[model samples]
Target: MAEIQAKDSGGKGGKPKAKKHSTKIDMTPMVDLGFLLLTFFVMTTTLAKPQTMEINMPVKAKDQEEQSQLKASNALTILMGENNKVFWYAGLPDAPAAPGVQVTDYSANGIRKVLLARRSNKDLMVLIKPMEKGTYKNMVDILDEMNITGIGKYAIIDVDPRDEELVKKVQ
Candidate 1:
């Protein structure tokens, strides 16, 4: 609703006064229309879908002996520690000729280099061991690296006691 009113200035010295008009605008329709547009946009707009990484786990073997046989040369172990520390070894840490555990970060030149070096091995399997002090971010970072490097076979296993000792020694 809108209205206009005229106000008369009082006559002074026997002179006629002029009238001034003032307009008032009602914004109720505008306010209601604004709310309707907001509601329409909110109801019709689509929200982003959550992004998730897909991991394919191996099927269990009936025989324990068959399941226990993992090639040492084809295995790579990555250990996540506190403060975003990363340590990796070419093969099993406790193998007969145990490989030395080397420390690396989560940068393109660090773990990525190591992963790329062995990417040619078709049977390469990466084993991720998150230590007690490691954060969830560390785990996610390594998993992302696995995806980035196109590593098909990988597992998130618990850190062994000997692996923990090795990590401590390197730290």
Candidate 2:
């Protein structure tokens, strides 16, 4: 019968011991990977431009009394249809005829004129009441124009007073 003998330690009076198991993980590679992912997200993620004015949207109300009070002074009511057409009405609603009442192709020129004229008074306000199917791009464009024209005073309104549900949903 063959007999197996254990290897002796270099100096100690004991058998050779197994190597100690390593539990340490290299964090450098993982940290590099995390930084790379963070950089990629920072490069690719789109940051939306913030709104200039604080819009106070009216709550869903059945009565017209609440709706009537929403129309304040220096309000510029802009009507946008599903077809991308923009119509603007300037000044108080009680005014028989809005001097700038016209359905025109969406452009900054017309908006600029109205806004500049209104900007004469620091307390002037402009209200935009777009339709339900109005594109967000259109709204953003209008907002951009307003910001560019230095008309910081404005509010968003519901074009259709009957559709309180839609207004609430959009708001």
Candidate 3:
């Protein structure tokens, strides 16, 4: 709705004055149209699907002896430490003649490269162990790396005492 109000001013000193008008615009329709468009868009638009990574964890064995043992040759153990430091070693940490522990980071050239290099081996298994001082983000980054490298067999595990010793020696 709109309206115009006119004011007529009589002549001053025998001269006629022009009429002045003020216009008022109603915004009800504009508001209604805005709401209608909002509702239409809200009803018509589709929400985006959440981005997520799928993980499959192994079932636990009831008996201690029933648990399957991972082969030393097929294993790559990654230890997450404070300050974004990452330590890795092949095979069991306590194995006789265990491979020397090496330090790396979460960068594309660091752990990602190591995982990519070992991705050719179908039997490759990765054990991710987060230390006491490691951040939750560190775990997430390692998991992301696993996904990026397409490493199929991996586990988030507790750090063993021997593994801690190895990491301590490295630090």
Candidate 4:
């Protein structure tokens, strides 16, 4: 509620005139109502839960050499390093004069497009080799890309000395 007060002041004709009082608004109820609505919304609304990508890792085997083999053409090797550097190539690193690594970024038009293009080949596999110089975030981002591309045949492998040498040459 709002009210006004008046003070008598002398006018030009010596007659007393009403002086307007400054406005004073009591916002106690308004503030209370605002908090009440806020509490109600907070209590009644459902918060979105954090989502996670499902990662399928290979189980440890006593005889690692017994694992099934993948064709060379079916493999794409990713080498991640600091400063947002990504070097990718086809076939194994030990292949005779293995394919030259192509430099790319993690953007939607970069690695994402590359992976999507390779999606056409169901038999194709992705091997992620994160170098010692690579950041943890780089690994996570590449993993996210794998899940986004719906790639079921991907593995996080250690950096081979030969692959490390290739990264140095490309970077």
Candidate 5:
């Protein structure tokens, strides 16, 4: 039988040594690449402003009977139809009437004028009731008008019964 033999040095009893391996990773290149990516993202991305419209949302009610009564004097209701037409009704709920109503087109200037005139009291609240087909852009424009007119205290009303279900389907 052939037998394996180890190499000896110094004519004595020394065996050949195995080559040493390095386990440490060279991190300089990796760190440089990470910094480059971070800088690129920082330079390319635009930072958005922190300003947002402060709007009060209505509480969820199980039934119309349990719905809380909102004061007519404090609340101003703006209605948006499916055709993108806007109408506004102010005063008591039972006696609600659309005054100086403009339809068929969205007018920020008119809305601004009306809101500014109506905002006699800083404590008054404005409520927006957007229909199902109402575009979000219209809502945002209305909010922008409100903001420009210094009407900050407002609420968004989801009067549509199918709103929650539609949102669920979308998600």
Candidate 6:
């Protein structure tokens, strides 16, 4: 909305000239429209949902020696190394008849395939041991793979010297 007003100059015994006018505009409508748009956007937009990782916490035991252990046949140890290298084996690394560590990548056909093949074994347990020099991303990728393969029984264990020796042998 605009309002116009005229300015009058004193006429002193001479012919009057054209009067000058000035325009004043009201910006209330524009301000109202701006607020309306802000409110609309605030009401219609959605906030992102937070992502989460599901973990099962172990229960406490009074005596450390009373813990139950998984059998070697059902245990699978996965070692996470640099360059996305994965070394896995069933049973302890130093045990007799235990298969030597084998190298594989983090692809669907690699670790995922191995996990899937052993998923049917009810007591199958996976122990992830990330190398000291390994990237945190390698650990995360294997954990994601563990979830994807639906392996419920799994643990993140410290790297054993024997396993580290095998890791060095692989590279």
Best by TM-score: 6
Over 1-171, each residue of candidate 4 has an lDDT whose tens digit, in order, gives 665666556568866676868666788899999999999999999999988777767779998999888888899999998788889998888787768989999999989988999999989999999888789999889998988888888888899999888877886
User: How do these models rank on TM-score, best leading?
Assistant: 6, 3, 1, 4, 5, 2
Q: Once superposed on the true structure, which residue ranges of model 5 sit more than 4 Å away at CA?
A: 1-69, 96-105, 160-171
Backbone clashes for every candidate come to 0, 1, 0, 0, 0, 0
RMSD over all Cα atoms, model 1: 3.2
| Better structure of 3 and 6 per lDDT | 3
- lDDT tens digits, residues 92-156, model 3? 88677967999999999999999998888889989999999999999889999998998878889
Whole-model lDDT for model 6 versus the true structure? 0.87
The TM-scores of all predictions, comma-separated, are 0.79, 0.47, 0.83, 0.73, 0.49, 0.85
**Can you tell me which runs of candidate 3 are displaced by over 4 Å?**
3-24, 46-49
User: Where is model 5 poorest over a 10-residue stretch in terms of lDDT?
Assistant: 162-171
Q: What is the TM-score (0 to 1) of candidate 2? A: 0.47
In order, the Cα lDDT scores of the candidates are 0.90, 0.64, 0.90, 0.87, 0.65, 0.87
Candidate 2 lDDT tens digits, 20-117: 44355567878899999999999999999995655456567887665444344556666665656666666554555533455654666666666676
Report per-prediction Cα RMSD to one decimal.
Answer: 3.2, 11.8, 3.0, 5.5, 12.5, 2.3
Deviation in angstroms for 81 in model 1? 2.1
The better candidate by TM-score, 3 or 6, is 6
Superposed model 6: Cα runs more than 4 Å off: 8-21
Q: Find the 10 residues in a row with the least total lDDT in model 1.
A: 61-70
Indicate the worst ten consecutive residues by lDDT in candidate 4.
1-10
- The residue pairs that clash in candidate 2, if any, are 76-127
Q: Across residues 1-171, which tens digit of lDDT does each residue of candidate 5 receive? A: 233444433343476555444355567888899999999999999999898766666667777797566676776767666655666656433444523333433665556667877889766788777876778898888778777888877777665443323323433
